[model samples]
Target: MELRQMRYFVGVAEELHFGRAAERLYISTPTLSQQIKQLEREVGTTLLIRHSRGVELTPAGQVFLARARETIQAAGLALKDTRRAAGLDEPVLRLGLLNGVPGWLPAALEQLAADRYPSSTVTLAAGTTVDQVRMLSSGEIDLGLVRTPLTLPVATTSEHLADEELGVLLAATHPLAERTELTLDDLAGLELIWIQRAAAPEFYDDALKRLGDQIRLSDISMSHSQLHSALRVRRGAISLGSCRAATPDVVWRPITGRPLVAKYAAIWRTDSHNPVLRSMTVSPGLTAVRQQVVAD
Candidate 1:
């Protein structure tokens, strides 16, 4: 019956999973379940049916979802109108950029934010995914370009932005360097350059799902410059990253069949209704940003 309950229900309904919805809403799974049960009792009908895989909405739940969304939208508009009548100034925009974020994504988002929030000053912070998640939870930043698989704060949610395709980077003289595309089998006996795991633990964990056990996974602290230096001087040294603009003595090749990807997302507090977040997330600019990233 409460707005919070409606929002919780909507999150669950959209995701069709209690645990995921709980994560997105920044609430415990038990709390979410209790709220939904209370909501169902008030409505005198079952809203969601739990299953082993996840949950599914009933006929009444579907109808309730439509009204709940409308109510939430109207409530947001009423709040905005009241704030405008009171002559409150726009809040400053605090944005966090993940470490090693693709340059073009931040550039496009920053430009869109400037256009939408001209009266509000914009600030940018750079940090790893772990750091950005902490900042988001503490309300230090209003929005962030962060890696996926992050357990966002209770008040926050995330939308996937794009992924960076990671390929093999090797010296031109390496045995596999001449191939247009390489597979996992081609990676044997070569050293892989990797960032420190402490920097982005969740991202590394998510990436582990795709990287099969066939290749030898090494733990090493290698910077981009160090990797480049090693690739130039050592024939067997290699790394996984964006292959754009390789040096004359170095080459990049795609992973055959499937690619290794570094996923990204835009994290923001769900209740903020931030105008700049609204502008890019719902407007055509989101697609434009994706296209720009692809073009780059």
Candidate 2:
């Protein structure tokens, strides 16, 4: 009927003697016997048979004892798991990132996390902003790093983590690569290549509309080769990407006299019970001013 009653029953069933069982359980023999009697009455079945030599379990008592022991063990395990989820034990931090992240970002995060939270584990998921947001909304992940001009509107707390000015990537011999910087007029009348469809379609399309009236798109998916080949032959061809994408092989020329910029932010669900999710908002050795300076 009650957990205390079940425990007493099990102790008695194991010891087979009221005196020994009471001593093992640190209770008085009379109290233990009274609780066992209460349990038998609640069950409407006699649990123990008292003989002159020693006590023995009845048929009903044996079956009930097995079930009671099982229930007690299961309850204990459940309590342990609940407490661990409450951050009493080591917790895992699930982090999601959009595609085309800098190669250095993960390294930076790992170094910082290792030095700070040595006991916690971090799992990384890389995908599109749309995919990351969907996973975050569904409670699949704790934190997400998404590109700005978000495709989907999320009901979560989002902060601008960093910004990288859009740069034009060109081959070594391209005519525009010789220039220190480019402007809207420099990109005019050029066979421009860019990300055709992304999570933030409106932002890309609207920015392109203002940059030049004559913009051309390629039928290439998210591939580096398409942009590389496009810039190989065409004199004015260019592809837009963050400064991180600007490698040594390709020249990274920032677009001047333009209001174009790509921003990235960290988002997390406000209702999540994960404490590791909340830690991401707290400064992990990063600052908004430093991010701006790097983007510059």
**Candidate that scores best on TM-score:** 1
Q: What is every candidate's alpha-carbon RMSD to the true fold?
A: 14.5, 19.2
Tell me the tens digit of each residue's lDDT in model 1 across 156-190: 77777788788888888888887999987778656
Task: Give me the runs in candidate 1 sitting further than 4 Å from their true place.
Answer: 1-91, 223-226, 230-234, 273-296
Q: State every prediction's TM-score relative to the real structure.
A: 0.61, 0.59
Q: lDDT scores for all predictions?
A: 0.77, 0.71
Error of 1 at 95 (Å): 2.0
Q: How many steric clashes between backbone atoms does each model show? A: 1, 0
Worst 10 residues of 2 by lDDT: 284-293
On lDDT, the candidate that comes out on top is: 1
Give the distance in Å from residue 45's predicted Cα in candidate 2 to where it truly belongs: 55
lDDT of 1: 0.77
C-alpha lDDT of candidate 2 relative to the true structure: 0.71
lDDT of 2 at 111: 47
